[model samples]
Target: MEQHTVVLYGKPGCGPCVAVKAALERAGIEYVYVDVTTSPEGLEHVRELGYQHTPVIETSDDHWTDFRPDKLAALAKGLGS
Candidate 1:
């Protein structure tokens, strides 16, 4: 199966971001990390998503903010096959 493209929007030292990244890595899910702290476009994207926090996870069909273990697991499992 084709690998899912996961985009993780976060900052450099966000704990939830770290946790999310770690979870994705553990699940063997490849992802693109977007550091909103470093790029103006990244920040703009987050704002467009109507979020004011870091650690936003977005796939081609879905997006969310904060840490959600169940959602993360589902994304990993869905794409891992």
Candidate 2:
């Protein structure tokens, strides 16, 4: 499997963010967590992406907002190959 980087930009106390983190962990996917509340750059990057919410997930080939199990499944499947 080719190594891919996943970055999760989220703030504290976000329910979806917590779910996304748990889903990624359950999928055995390693990811870097950026607290947007503390990281100015991360907040700027998420805003630049046109998202006004937390739990912004960015993979090597795609990016999305909110807790999406289907997307996480696809990411796992892609990484498995």
Candidate whose lDDT is highest: 2
Look at candidate 2 and tell me the lDDT of residue 38: 96
List, residue by residue over 1-81, the lDDT tens digit for candidate 1.
Answer: 124678999998899999999998998988899899888998999999999999999898888999999999899778853
Over 14-34, each residue of candidate 2 has an lDDT whose tens digit, in order, gives 999999999999899889999
The reply for model 1, stretches above 4 Å from the true place, is 1-3
Q: How many angstroms is residue 24 displaced in model 1 relative to the true structure, after the best TM-score fit?
A: 0.4
TM-score of each model, in listed order = 0.92, 0.93
Supply the global lDDT for candidate 1.
0.89
In candidate 2, residue 55 scores what lDDT? Answer: 96
TM-score of 1: 0.92
Clashes of 1: 0
